[model samples]
Target: MEVRVLPGEHFYGFLRFYGKGITFPKGHVESGETYEQTALREVSEETGYKNLEIVKSLGVVTRPAIETDGTEVIKDIYLFLMKITGDDKGKAEEETEWLTIDDALTRLMPQEVEFLKKIQLEIYED
Candidate 1:
């Protein structure tokens, strides 16, 4: 997920999946692409904001997930701290919204909420 501070508040970028609900932007890494590169591209594609810079690595989250075909798998999600670097905008390919920490905590999945809460203080200090 990406967070940016504007005036008095910090906002998180979230994508609304049609049947899956809201979550951060994520995608499979393309050939020859690093995890950071994939994150930057996916965020830009889903949020329509091209200007972003990675501030730091936020660690990783490994979880069990069921695929559309009912296959279960373990997924490793790499999290990063990123910030908006410019005002460039375009039409988003997916439904996207910028929400405050409190709103995001309520709307995100339990696992994700835990992750966010763990870094909440760090975000505030930035």
Candidate 2:
């Protein structure tokens, strides 16, 4: 997942998943692709913002997940702190929103909120 911050305002970029609520952009790692590569691709595909610079990694979060077919699995979510380098935009596959930390805390999922909280200070300090 990407914690994408827009410069100046420091608004965080989030994706709204229908029925699932708001969260960061993320996707599976394709074969022969590095985790960073997958993160960049997924962010672009989901938010349509291509001009991004990865500030640093926020580490990985491992959690149990349930698939649509009721399959249980462990998911490792790699978190990256990315910043928008330009105003370039494209077609987004999902709905995207930019929000202040307060607004994002209110709208984001519980787990996502927790993750944001853990890195809140780090994000601002960067």
The sequence of per-residue lDDT tens digits that candidate 1 reaches over residues 1-126 is: 455455777787888865656787787899999999998998888888899898877777666767889999988878777888889978788888788889888887778888888978887776
Candidate 2 backbone collisions, by pair: none
Model 2: how far residue 106 lies from native, Å: 1.9
Worst 10 residues of 1 by lDDT: 1-10
Measured by TM-score, the strongest candidate is 1
Q: After superposing candidate 2 on the true structure, give the runs of residues whose Cα lies further than 4 Å from its correct spot.
A: 1-8
What's the TM-score of every candidate structure?
0.85, 0.84
Full-model lDDT, candidate 2? 0.80
Model 2: lowest-lDDT 10 consecutive positions: 1-10
Superposed Cα deviation of residue 74, candidate 1 (Å): 2.2
Q: lDDT of each model, Cα atoms only?
A: 0.80, 0.80
